[model samples]
Target: MGWRIRNGMSISIWNDCWLLGFPVRKVTSSQSTQVDLVSDLIDMDERSWNIDLINPIFNEADIESILDIHMSNSNQNDILCWKGEGSGLYTNLLTKRVSISNFCPRCNQSIEDNTHVGRDCPYARKVWRLLDIRWSDDASNLCFKEWLLRLFMTHNKGKHICIAVTIWSLWFARNRIICEHQYPLFVAIVQKCRMYLRHFSIRTHVLAWWKPPLEPTTKLNFDVCFSYAHQKSCSGFIIRDSAGFVLGSGFIHTHHITYVFMAEALVILQGVHFAKDIGITRSTLESDSKKIT
Candidate 1:
């Protein structure tokens, strides 16, 4: 008999052995099941966090076991229509029971589905172009499944989350337009995504500040290197210990440089200031610039 996973419960299986049950003989059929389990693990590694937006495409049992979230089909097309394309997958909203196209606020146009609202909708298309993104030309023409699968495959952890968030925000904007009979603006949607991604990166520790440790006894020939770079001059410095251990390094951003001597002088000055800040009183200052020397 085929193993069954019922709704409202979670479980795992390996080689015809239930995680909570007695072990069974290693049957060849069980091999296929094991392969699926391994694939699920690999997919999970691609993401840093998991938030289910709708019923998973797979069976409820597999989703429950893998995602740790219960899965059920709730016919969420109406919600999808309200939210813009590329969005609904990151939310917990209930999908309306009615078929999405049964009623269209934009009755002048055909009922909007996933592809229509996301790719073909006139308003959404304008938004995509403004952001310099190109969706498929024909909403109904492209291979939707293939396209979505590619998104999962190509994006890195950060960009992938951005993609999901972008779609979700777009959908939310669409819903506002449909329900309030208000016009949607493209800039608003893009801005919302930018803010959200920025915040998400901060919260997830993806975007962080770099503060190097102080070095007390760095012995470098050059305390700072100042020179003109590009049209503008910049100051840079290298820190090393008395034993020649490199401590820290960086350059500062500044306006255009007037002359090379000024650049080197500025570099020395900045390096001394930094050394002072780091509690270095007597550092051996050296520079290739004879003027600074």
Candidate 2:
């Protein structure tokens, strides 16, 4: 799985497969990035590539690939896609099922039935056990389909999703062993599943309603939009009371701002000073950035 960047907030800069044509489907020029997300490299307001920043950080090939990615003018978040395919239909993108050996590819000790390969196999059992969730590993009597049905009947909806992802990951591991003659480490497969889950976790767990500040204390929410190509940023903060009344608000469009975190920090600092100027004694700072607040 890979990302089709819209706002790029969801895609990782150094690790995700945003850049096509690369062997690992990632940036080869830089092994690490100061910024976390690919959105940091984009000029969000202008809806274009950050050319000045891109030229210096990435190799020529990667730079070209990044530039080729078109930016949508809409406010939609980054999209997760399979192989960055144009059709955007998962049904066609899936690998065609092929026949494999009757015996388990990894252990070769047991018959490779759907139930045995997915659960009873030594490798699959280890993969499930390594997962953070408490799993009932003794579903040996149930077939794969019945086992899934029982799991859904017992667990919550969230656990069902986790179980589905775990099964898919196990299938991937089994496929590798069958086709490539490669036995993936159980830990490695589990790590990939966790990373995939982490990406969705942010969007999935959004609050349905906002909780206001207590009594007289105000909430100061600060945000920043940065452009690396222009070396400029637009930051703002809004202060509101428990009643949702906007008490004070301000914004700044400035130059020479280089990094996303710097912009976020600056906005937060400026917000505090702004609140102080407005005579807001007791206030709670709020920001979407995990690094800043």
Candidate 3:
């Protein structure tokens, strides 16, 4: 079991089951009475674990697991969950199928299991290499659970989430190939996982307030709305002065956009052309979408 640290106020460093591995306990220290809550190891202002403060007290693997634990931005209480089940949503009933077959549909390999699907498979290894992860070539000896535990426990929260999503995406791609007879590109899988991670992180953090430009400069704020059902995308832009007064606004609707990023890029390009046509020489552009901005 592992603890998801939310507020990090109640969990103890030595006593609580927080870190990964068996019998969670902090490294022995001479000044043992000094430690208390897990929050003591985190920097409040930065909202990140304090490496300098904890480096001497924990081994590299333990420290990595401590850091890899996701910290919620919301003001929620700490919760304990089973770490064996990735994402902690598993149940005994879910494992009733129990297929004894050992064959990989993706690569037609003789052995197939969680470990082969997630890490040892050639396809899976390609995706990991594309993401520039430091995967050991001789890691075939480790079981699926052991491999994933070591892989995720060494990285930060964002990378951990990305890796998890990537593995899931790879599995989905494999299914699509086998069931739907559709080829899924490696780049597409990686991009999909990265986009999911980006959106997840954005949802966790609060948006900043829009600030007006200073002095004689004007600001151009552009946005795009896509209708997946209609296969069309529309863009709008508003030009505001230093005082937050709208100087001009324009809208354009177009068809043939393949994805949200394409639509956003089109809107930004159009916004620039619109600004130039309106003779707004001194203007700053802004967009709420991180991919666009």
What range of 10 consecutive residues in model 1 has the weakest lDDT sum?
75-84
Q: By TM-score, how accurate is candidate 1?
A: 0.33
Model 3: lDDT equals 0.68
State which candidate, 1 or 3, has the greater lDDT: 3
For lDDT, the strongest prediction is 2
Give Cα distance to truth, residue 11, candidate 2, Å: 25
In model 2, where do residues sit more than 4 Å from their true spots? 1-100, 132-138, 205-293
When 1 and 2 are scored with TM-score, the better candidate is 2
Lowest summed lDDT over 10 consecutive residues: which window, candidate 2?
A: 84-93
User: For model 2, what is the C-alpha lDDT against the true structure?
Assistant: 0.69
Cα deviation of 83, candidate 3, in Å: 19
TM-scores for all candidates? 0.33, 0.37, 0.37
For residues 1-293, what per-residue lDDT tens digits would candidate 1 score against the true structure?
A: 11222221222324333211111111222233323332233223433213342133335544444454222222110000011113323222225443333333433375555555555566666665665555344433665455555655655665666667766676667655543345557788888878887878766843343233345545333333334446455555665554444544444444566676666666666566545544557666655565765
Error of 1 at 209 (Å): 23
Instruction: Flag regions of model 1 displaced more than 4 Å.
Output: 1-108, 135-140, 206-293
lDDT of 3 by residue, 148-219 (tens): 777777787658767878777876686566434568777888788778878878766644567999979989
